[model samples]
Target chain A: MQALNQILRRIPVWAVYLLGAIPAPWLFYQGLTGSLGVDPIEALEHRYGELALQLLIVVLAISPLRRFLGLNLIKFRRALGVLTFVYVSLHLLVWLILDVQVPSQIWADILKRPYISVGMAGFVLLLPLAVTSNNLSVRQLGPRWRSLQRLVYPAAVLGGLHYVMQAKGFQIEPLVYLSVIVGLLLLRVPFPSLLNRFRQVDSA
Target chain B: GVGLAGMARGAAAQEALEPNSWEEITSYNNYYEFGTRKEDPAKYAHTLVTEPWSVKIDGLVDKPGEYDFQDIMSEMTVEERIYRFRCVEAWSMVIPWNGFELADLLNMAGVQDGAKYVAFETAYRPDEMPGVQYPVLDWPYREGLRLDEAMHPLTIMATGIYDRPIPNQNGAPLRLVVPWKYGFKSIKSIVRVTVTDVEPPTSWNVAGPREYGFYSNVNPNVDHPRWSQATERPIGGGLFAKRIPTLMFNGYEQEVAGLYEGMDLAKNY
Candidate 1:
């Protein structure tokens, strides 16, 4: 764990950005080269979507880890969140531009498929969060900034639901990520201070 | 894996294998994977290993026997049958399946007169197949048909696909492939095929008896509980504009639809 942390610390933030950016180009190049074997666009979409979800899970884990484990890699959270948004945006763009060429059909698919509906909700909610990730926007928004960032929780749930629906035969891996986000949220909720006696005993 | 080599041997026994593009293969999946998702089979099937298999033929057969994987292959001729596979979920795939007639196998086994139905079961291993581990589906995948459906000329005891011994991803070793019905009717990785007098409850039908029926014939009119029954997306096409008009009995209505002339297909489905 220490080695991983040290390695992560050494890598420049741009390197993280570039690392996140690589899969898109690599998959696109595979598509261009016809290495995806068949239905390159759909394959590309699946790859991008999966990677985007993974990045989203990683981003959601940041604050929870800091609070529980006292690991303050706080500087990377905003960048990681933005990276997730970038991957998700690419995923949506690939679907819109390549998979469904017609605007009406894309609209129809989003409206018709319940899974797509939740996924679109996540995408739409992520837009404002991504836009506000910058320091200037955060400064402009001020007090409302924290509230705007709260959208991530719902966005995470929606994103997880999209994956759950996509899975066949009740895969629980996606649900675990959803649970982690829910657990983190639960940790923040105020409780009756029965812990005072326990803490006092510990200190004594 | 040993199965991969077995497949190579099987391919060598036949003519050059028909190597399908991933689009053609992935889109055209046997519907047992995710209820009715086109890509679900390929995705969930990563958990399946199609090697070290056998088929037990029991109950009301004159020559009741357990056929090992190797011997089952030596018995039949693998002919290419390119049929249109229509799913109840409103998707279709033109699969170039390579398998011989189930009739030949049954005749070899000498099925008795009292055998009224043929029940098929998949190998139920939750540890190996994560799909089985989940409560989303009932354990031990199952499907059944009236003895006549089993005897239908279109019914094939498929051991291979694309002129090759079936890939682990595509119900390898031994499986039933009934072209006329919805793809789920073709049970994958079959371990047992029992001849019985009573109509057996199939997996999906038992899961949602009202929605999925015993006779899940490919009827365009009988809509599933969730989706339209009228059309299907041909594998290899994009989400939009690629769905084609689903044929009645998957274009085998003339051959098999007569088997269910008066029965309410909607009720049975």
Candidate 2:
């Protein structure tokens, strides 16, 4: 674990940001070249949203990974969060400009459809976090920044819900995503003292 | 009113009438019995054995027997129809389907006075159709139409596309093509077609009553619970292409609107 942490420490956060962003343009090029399949726009949109969700899951895992395994990826979490936001923005752009097209219907869909509404709400929650994901804001806000960043918990939950509600039928993929998000969120909550006592009893 | 070829959807239709390539037509499909993804059918449908294809015609019809595909083809006239294929998922395409009017086959079978609905069922081979094993839908994908809608000259049992034998991915050998209705209404790889007095249960409608109604005729005014049906992104259009407003009854309103005179489209949708 010490060796792995040392290795992780040597890896530059900028490298993580650079490597994570390759998919954004590569996916677009694939769509442009007809490699994304028959419905390239849809494929592109889905891929970006999926990438965002997957990164969000990874972001959620960082704290747990450090606590349980002593493998700290704390340095890369901010970069990962920013990259996730970029993918989410690309997903929304593809839907708005490329897929949906009509200006009137754009607001209509975001407001009317439950999945879109939830996704939009999630994006709205993440706006301040992305804006304040800097060194100066971190120092200025201090403890308040910690509480504000906690908004990611609900934002990620909403992202999972959006995915769950969008599928045509009862799809297991989206349900699995939602379950993982909820499980990770549960992990962050401190277990009751009574439960800790029971655990000590079992060990004894 | 003998197909869109004669009925004519006008100049705007013509502007959009360059049929999507055979590759696009076959590759992108929604035959859920094969799988749920748009590309799933193309990937997995080749396993289906369409050689000894037969359709069981029964219910209120006079000739109620299992008819072989070749025998059925020998008795009918086939023609090419250019149609605007609209999916309930807000995608659209132009397809040139070659087949005969469904009315001809129903007529040959001899409809009884009691007949009110025409129900069709797709082949359900769990060994061949991998998607069926998971029960994504009630097996043997089902679809139905009002007797009048079935007899409409526009409705066809498409056998081929682009003058080539239809590929298994595109519901080869046999499939229904109701140009005005959402693509799912046109069930694929059909094996059973029954005529009855009662309205038969349709797979999608049975699955979600609130979302998909029995009458799934394309109506821009009626939005689906999940997405707007007001416009559709035409397939084959490049990434930046804008969505066009969806036509009422998929530009077949002039021909088939009389079929639902007193009924409310929003309620039915």
Candidate 3:
């Protein structure tokens, strides 16, 4: 575990960015070579959406990992966040350009479909976070930046809900993902005070 | 009665427009009774007991009884037909089906004068089909057709595909195959057939009336509210292959269009 931490510490943020960017071209190659099953467009769209969700989960885990395990991955969090936004954008683009080609129909879907509306809501919340990810915006916004970035919590919840609602029937995989997200959110609750209360009760 | 040799000759003679691979046809299915995934039925449907199967022919039929599957097969003459099977979800496949016309079966059952519709019920075996445990849909999936639609020459009671007995996943023993309507209208693994005067309630229409109408004829002009039906992806076509434009009545307009004469298809849809 110590050696693993040392290796993680030595890895540069740029390396994380490069690794994250690799899937994009690999997916494109899969598309070109007809390796993405019968419905390629749908496959590509699903892959991007899943990748984005997975990255968001990783981002949510970073803080808990740092606090409980002393694994500080703070430096790469920004890169991970940026990669999540990229994948989410690509997912949306695939739906827009490939799946639903009609402009009017696209607007109708965003307005009418509950899943699409929630997914769009998540994307909208992430937009400002993507824009203000730089050091300049952090310095300018000062203390308010942290409060604004707290929108990630709700955005992640919406993303999970979107996945659950889109399925035709009860599916366990999406439910598992939503449960994990909920668990991560629950872990964020301040638990040190509860631990102290338990310690006091034991002593008394 | 047509012999098995004649049936084989008929199957060999029919021209298939776009023959789907046997692997593709057998592997992918939408048998929600087994499960929702396209591949689930292929994995789970083998548990379904097909032998000793019987279909209850009741309601307005003169001869109402549980007819044995083997007896039904023995009485009828089988032939082959190549048809386009289009799904409501905008995907399609061309399959060569082997069976007899449903008209012959209905005639043999002696449809009473009052019968206006033919209702079908799929087998509800929870032990065999795990999906039946969930309320994904009302149990014992049901579908219906107007008496005329049921009697149409294109409508067949398919027992096999690709000149072989259809696997359980693809509705073994017996199933209805309505060539023009969306594939869901072709009820699978049927256990009952009722000829009734009233228009029967269909499973999908009952689940969501606004989304799935009683008449699910394939018309590209009428979009499915959630997705456009203008084009369809053919199963087994390479991932990057361009979607082909969907045809009206799935290219059977000439054969089935007259059945809907003087009716507003858009409203009925």
Reference contacts preserved by each model: 0.19, 0.54, 0.29
What candidate 2 gets wrong by more than 4 Å, as runs, is B1-5, B9-16
The i-RMS of every model, in angstroms, reads: 4.9, 1.2, 3.2
lDDT of 3 at B25: 83
User: What TM-score would each prediction reach against the true structure?
Assistant: 0.76, 0.96, 0.82
Write the residue-wise lDDT of candidate 2 on B98-177 in tens digits: 99989999988999998999999998899999888775677778999999999988899999999988899888889999
Tens digit of per-residue lDDT, candidate 3, span A152-191 = 9999999999888877645676887888888899989988
- lDDT per residue for candidate 3 within B111-206, as digits (tens), equals 999889999999999999988887778878999999999998788999999999988999988999997889999999999999999999998899
The order by descending TM-score is 2, 3, 1
TM-score, cand. 1? 0.76
- Using lDDT as the measure, name the better of candidate 2 and candidate 3: 2
In candidate 2, what are the lDDT values of residues A44-72, reduced to their tens digit? 99999999999999999999999999999
Number of the top-ranking candidate, with TM-score as the measure: 2
Predicted structure with the largest DockQ when compared to the true one: 2
- What tier of docking accuracy does candidate 3 attain? acceptable
At residue A142, candidate 1 shows an lDDT of 99
